[model samples]
Target: MLFRQLFDPETSTYTYLVADEGNGEAALIDPVLARVDRDRRLIEELGLTLEYAIETHLHADHVTGGGKLRELTGCQTVIPEKAPATCADRVLQDGEVLQIGEIPVRAIATWGHTDSHMAYLVNRDRVLTGDSLLIRGCGRTDFQSGDAGTLYDSISQRLFALPDETLVYPGHDYRGYTVSTIGEEKRFNPRLARRDRSDFIELMANLNLPHPQRIAEALPANAQCGCLSETP
Candidate 1:
């Protein structure tokens, strides 16, 4: 298996390229539109054919590169089945395994940040944890279809149950922490470490983060991978 973790400093987002080095067939996860060209260049440089561009959920920060990848390479778009987006070529169900150059990637439902949010488990050791889990904290449950209590359950019940050695790759993290082990996060993440559901909710409520500037504009476009009919 081959992997590359790309970060967009502006939005603190992470894009990933996972491929089978044996055959050069690859897939991208949660890519950023602003850096699509760079990612495409790397794909070409590696002599890999892009097979799929996956989005864990509709983003509220920046536009997604899934559609642009499709436009450029004719790659298929994979997303969760519950997503409201119509552009996904494949709707993934929990426990479904997708083959990428012979490697099996399993989909895990993690609905907290959004009702349709998902986490991709690769070979049972690495997880693409969209917005559900981060290095020192987790995603805010104040957004669309988000419930604080539900988020708590998703973490303790679903993610925390995984093996301690499993590696985690989150969607966005601004603190420069790229990746972490499930055990490390479980024992150290300020929010999850406490194992207190009510405390987590209270912390989120007090964050007072301003609504994302492009949220309204980004959602509809992101849902469809920025293929919205409106002008940009």
Candidate 2:
């Protein structure tokens, strides 16, 4: 297995490249439109064939590169089931596994950051927690039909149930963090530490965070897999 974490500094987004080294087949998760060329170059340099461009949800912060990647590499575009990405080549349901050569990317429904979202558990070890669970904080549940209480449940009941040693790779990180263990986040995440669901809900409700600068442009574009021409 080969794994590389790529970042988009502008949006603090993390795009991941996962592949089966033996077969040289790869998948790019949560790619950003602006960074597509860079990602493509890396894939080519590594002698890998791009097999899929996957998204965890329809993002409100940055546009996806799925559509362009499909055009450039002929790789399929995959989004979580019910994400409103009509252009997606496939929609992954919870517990469904998509194979990238010999590697298995299992979808774990972790909604609430967005009404439809998924965290991919790669090869049963690391979990690509796309805004579901962060290092010491979690995503804001203030828009895109986000529900604080539901997010609390998903993190506590679903994510926390995984092995403590499991690696947690978040979708975005503003604080320079690169990775964390499930146990570390479970014990230290200020957002979820000892708060009950209700408390967590209240905390999230009062965050008063401003909306993402690109929401107006990103939402519609992301829904179409980031084909700006089709964005409205």
The candidate scoring highest on TM-score is: 2
Q: Which ten residues in a row have the lowest lDDT in candidate 2?
A: 223-232
Lowest-lDDT window of 10 residues in candidate 1? 223-232
Q: Where does model 2 exceed 4 Å of error?
A: 230-232
Q: Name the Cα RMSD for model 1.
A: 1.4
Q: lDDT tens digits, residues 1-232, model 2? A: 9999999999999999999999999999999999999999999999999999999899999999999999999999999988977999899999999999889999999989999999999999999999999889898899999999889989999999999999999999999999999999989999999889989998998999999999999999998899885436
lDDT of 1 at 2: 88
Candidate 2 clash pair list? none
True-vs-predicted CA distance for residue 225, candidate 2, Å: 0.6
Q: Tell me the deviation in Å of residue 149 in model 2.
A: 0.7
Against the hidden reference, what TM-scores do the models get? Answer: 0.96, 0.98
